[model samples]
Target chain A: MTTAVLFDNVSRHFGVVRAVDRVNLDIAEGEFFAMLGPSGSGKTTCLRLMAGFEQPTGGHIEIFGETAEGVPPYRRSVNTVFQDYALFPHLSTLDNVAYGLMVKGAGREERRKAAEDALAMVKLPGYGTRRPGQLSGGQRQRVALARALVNKPKVLLLDEPLGALDLKLREQMQEELKSLQKSLGITFVFVTHDQGEALSMADRIAVFNEGRIQQLGRPEEVYNQPKTRFVADFVGSSNVLSTKLCQRLGVKAAFASLRPEAIALAAPSNGALSLAGTIAGQSFLGATNRVVVDVDGARIAVASPAAHAVPAIGSPVTISFAARDLHPMEDA
Target chain B: MRSEKSNRAPLSLKIAAAAGLAFMHLPILLIFLYAFTTEEKSYQFPPPGLTTQWFGVAWDRPDVWAALALSVKVASIATATALVLGTLCAAAISQTRFFGRETISLLVILPIALPGIITGIALRSAFSMADIPFSFWTIVLGHATFCIVVVYNNAVARFRRISGSLIEASMDLGADGFQTFRYVILPNIGTALLAGGMLAFALSFDEVIVTTFTAGQQSTLPIWMLEELIRPRQRPVTNVVAMIVVVVTFLPILGAYYLTRDGDQIAGASK
Candidate 1:
């Protein structure tokens, strides 16, 4: 796949603080890529650098095979849907949607027709005459989407585009945005702190922590085979156990991450990786019963079906997982 | 029961507000009333008869027209100068972070905060040192000293309220820097600029102390009014012009209030 955007050892610093440290990433063309991290993890800063809003202090960025140095955002073949929408308050919905084409010096009739079509694609047809203030939050968000998409950019940069929406609306927008990207065949660089959002919408996700990409892969791959403790913890619920490998099970790392669902709570098994512990807490989820067991000095969580019969808080239990289920992660 | 308590304090507050309004406007009302009175020279509690004959007389005076034209010209020039400088300064200050930003902001605000006489004397001394002739440009320069503060205040506040992300969004959407300024930033700040320009014009129109110090022989409408007040040849005409000033100034003030009333929400939306 052709690389749509590449960050080659790029780093950005604000005074003494390094916001983005020595980052290298390659986002493929027509890929719906997500940068997932906690706030201040430099995900937003990374997006801003790609958008040409900020220049990297070290190294270079390439977009569509062209080096992006000293390139203003407008010169780049990319568009952004800002977090707050940033629809023009003074202009009507039509004008706001048509702003990009109008700035490109498109004719009045052409802009009107293009804007109408873009607005319709977002499922807001006759909202043309209403000001942004008059529109609902979802409608305003759609207007912002239409405004960016009207230009038909090679890449669409969404900075937590659905961050402002309520849960239900955000879910709906995530699907819509994904479908829109698929149909348009344009690259999408979505930034979000919400793990669920990234997991749901991305073709691939770059999991960032402390200004570095800990792991980048398909959502399921990243979740199942996390390379770092931070990635395993960040991507999904995993019980990171401080383990001394009693025997080599073909994995190289010293520590293992046992996913809650992968662990089986039972009496000490004869031929599995077994650890004895006392149950410290228990909670019953609808489908699964979660039990936290204190193994040595570490607390390990295990999830099993409610039908499996969970142990009491003080009951001694041996939690075991198959050798393959013990996913090893690099030491922190 | 809730409505009763809610209404009680507001009722007393309304009465107090009304009293304050009367206290402020009673003198202007007197001027308006006397402008239409039959009595031409001396003051009286109530006029003998209502007539607009003095308005006709005021209209006929060549000096009144001259002063009115000069005032209009000075106001127009000063407002234009202030708008350009103020907007440029505001955009410059808002777009970048530098050393002494707060100090620069304070310096920009100092002209309006200082007494009018201080600004006037400062401008006078500066003009004297430069040996520049005090003509129409001098009056405009003097008016602009304070007018720039008004425009800068409005523009900077409006600029600060706008989200930097919006500008970034615009550029990311394929708008050049000029296009972003023209389409995004300009449209967003239009109401603020209008409010600022209106206030600057109003300030320049009635500025007497600064104009007196800056204007050598050229007289503005307020200076003319002051001359008329001292020597009562056409006292009622001065009242007539004062009535006009009140109306002109009042409309823009009302306009500015309404424009800025929803400003907070505008800021929130941009963010």
Candidate 2:
């Protein structure tokens, strides 16, 4: 697979603050990639750099094998769906969608036809004449998508596009966006702080913390095989055991993390590392029960099936998991 | 309880509000009332009869036409100048950060904040020191000083309300800087600039003190009206001309008020 976007040791510093530290990354062509992080983690900065909204302070950035350094946003072959939608309020929905074509100096009739087609692709056909102010939040988001896609750029960068929507709408849009990206075969780079959204939609996820990518891999790889303590704590609810505790279990590693799902509430007949502890808390989470066990002063969480019997809080119990389930993690 | 409170505005407050409105507008109403009065000399209450002959008289006078023409010319020129300079100033202050931005903004608005008489005196002294002769352009320049403030006030408020993301989105969608401005920034601030221009026109139309200092032997509508008031020739005709000025100035102010009246929201950025 060819690399669509490459950031080789790219860094952006705003005075004393390093917003995006020197980072190397590659996004393959036609891949659905996500930059996931909390606010101030520099995920948005990376997306902006790709869009040419910001120039890297050091190192190099290439888009589709061409250097993107010192290029203005209009000159780049990348489009962005801003977090706030940012549709043109003064123009009709059709006009807003056709803006890119107009800027590119296309004929009026041709741009209008393409804009309408793009709108239909986003499932908002015949929404041409209405002003952006008249549309609902979801409709406006679709308009923003239509506007970005009208240009048919090499990469589409979405900066938390569904952040303003309600939970139900966000989930629905996520499905639509994924399907759209698949059909278009255009590389989609989505930046968001919502881990669930990133995990559910993106084929690959980059977990970022403090201006650095802690880990980057497929969703399951990042979640199940986290390489750092930061990633293990961030990607999913994993209990990271201290190095001293791991030595007690005969594992020679700086730190070991175990997923809640990997931990069994009952002792296994097969040889498995077991820890006896008292149930500190148990909460029902639909299909699963999250049971927090106090084991040797460390609270290890175990995700038990909701159908099974749950021990009362403060009750003594033993949780067991196979040795292979514990994954070694680097101290970040 | 809410209905009762809203329905019964306190009697004293109602009276006070009515009194305040009458105090402000009664003089203008009197100007309209006296326009039709048959009385040609001295102050008269409830005149013996009313006639429309003064309207005919005011219409026939060449001086009245000349003054009206000059007033329109000066206001038009001033408004145009204000539209360009004020908007440019507002954009610079609003869209970019620079040292002393706040101070420059204060200075831009300082012309309108100062008393008109002081502004007039200052312009007069400065003009005399510079050995510049007072003429049509001087009045236009004098009016533009404050007209620019009016435009800047409206333009700056609208500029600040515009979201920065809209500009970025335009650029990201393959629009150059000029294209983004024409397609995004201009539409957002168009109504505000138009309203500011209208207000500036109205202000310059009826201006007298600054015109008095800057106009050397030229008589704009207000200056003409002042001379007619002091010298007392065809007094009812002067009242008729005054009525025309009142209507001409009032219409633009009203237009400006409505244009900017729910202007907090720009086109696409409205919540």
Candidate 3:
């Protein structure tokens, strides 16, 4: 796939604070790329820079091989779905959706037809006459999507688009937005602080921290083999064991990251690393039972089948995992 | 289930508020009431008869017509000038930040905050120093000084309420700067501008102190009213015009209040 959006060493600073520090990223055409991070991690700043709402203090941004410097946002071939879904409250849904086409000076009939088609694409077939204030939160969000998508932008930027919805609605919109992105066949650069939203939607995820990308890879690759301690702690729940190299296990490094699902309660019959522990706590989580095991003054969380027999609190148990399960990081 | 005590204010406070409202409005209301009365010479409460002759008299007077026409001309010109300058100032101030922004904003707001006599005196001084002739243009200039503040306050407040993301969204969707302003920013602030224009027109229409200083021999409606009060030919006719001013000003104020009632909702939508 061709690169659709590229950020070349883009850095943005506000006085003494560095919001987006020398970030390099390339989003592939038709790929849903998500920037995942905690609040204040500069993911939003990167999105703003790409949208041209903010100018980078240094470096360059390109969309469709065109340098984006000194280009006002309105002249860009990208659209953003704001976190609050900034729909025009005074205008009806159809008018709001038709705004871009109207600005392009399209004929009134043509713009109306296009707006109707776009609203239909978002499954709000005939709610065109209603104002944004009259719509529900989910409907308002869909209107925002339709308004942006109606412009046929080369890239669609979503800044925490589903951040305002309730959990069930958010999950539904996530799937809807993913399918929408796929059907449109346009590059999507999504920014979200929610790891689950990023993981579920993105073809690849860039995990950010302190104004830099800590790791960027496919969701499973980043989750299964996180590059840093921050990534390991951020991407998914893991029992990150900080250990000094007692001995070299082949060519792998000392510090190990064992996924919760990979650790087994049964003792190792074969030559695998084993640790004796007591079940500190256990909780049933529908399909799985998460047990916190206290091992050598360290807490390691283990997830097993819900039907698996679990020891009582303070009961002694042996936790074992194979060498391959321990994905060690080369650098601390 | 509400207690009566909760509904009651302190007796002194209630009496004070009543006194203040009465003091402000009693004369204006009396003017309206007497516009229909038959009294021709001196002021009298509970006049001997009621007639609508004063409206006809005020309407027919050539001097009243001339003064009214001049007031309309000055007010329209001042309001138009203020709207253009004030909206531009609001847009410029809203988008970017630099040193002395607060000071500049304070200066913009200062004309309306200061006593009208002070603004009148300042305008008179400035015009005299520049050797500008005092004509209808001078009256417009004086009225626009305070009128710009009205328009600017309304426009800036509305601009501040609008989401920056909406403008960004417009641009991201392939709109140029002018297109964004035309479609997005302009539509969002249209009501605000209308409301501001109405208020500025009202202020300019009724302005007296500033017009007195700057108008020289030319007479606006308020300056005409001041002259009519001191040397009255038909006293009831002046009251009729005063009633007209009240009605004209009242409508726009009501319209402005309704226009801004949902302003918070628009602001909340962006957050």
Q: How do the predictions measure up, each by TM-score?
A: 0.92, 0.94, 0.90
Off by over 4 Å in 3: A245-254, B1-26, B32-41, B44-57, B232-234, B261-271
Clashing pairs in 1: none
For TM-score, the strongest prediction is: 2
- Tens-digit lDDT track of model 3 for B151-201: 999899889878777777777777787887887888788888888998999
Interface C-alpha RMSD, model 1 = 3.3
Pairs with backbone N, CA or C atoms under 3 Å apart (clashes), candidate 3: A73-B171, A74-B171
Instruction: State residue A321's C-alpha deviation in candidate 3, in Å.
Output: 0.9
lDDT of 1 by residue, A229-325 (tens): 8988888778776645333334567666778988888654666777788999989898988888897767888888989877778888888787777
Docking class of 2: medium
User: What are the fnat scores of the candidates, in the order listed?
Assistant: 0.69, 0.83, 0.69
DockQ of 1: 0.51
Alpha-carbon lDDT, every model:
0.87, 0.91, 0.87
- What does candidate 2's lDDT look like per residue over A121-208, in tens digits? 9999999999899899999999999999999999999999999999999989999999999999999999998888889999899999
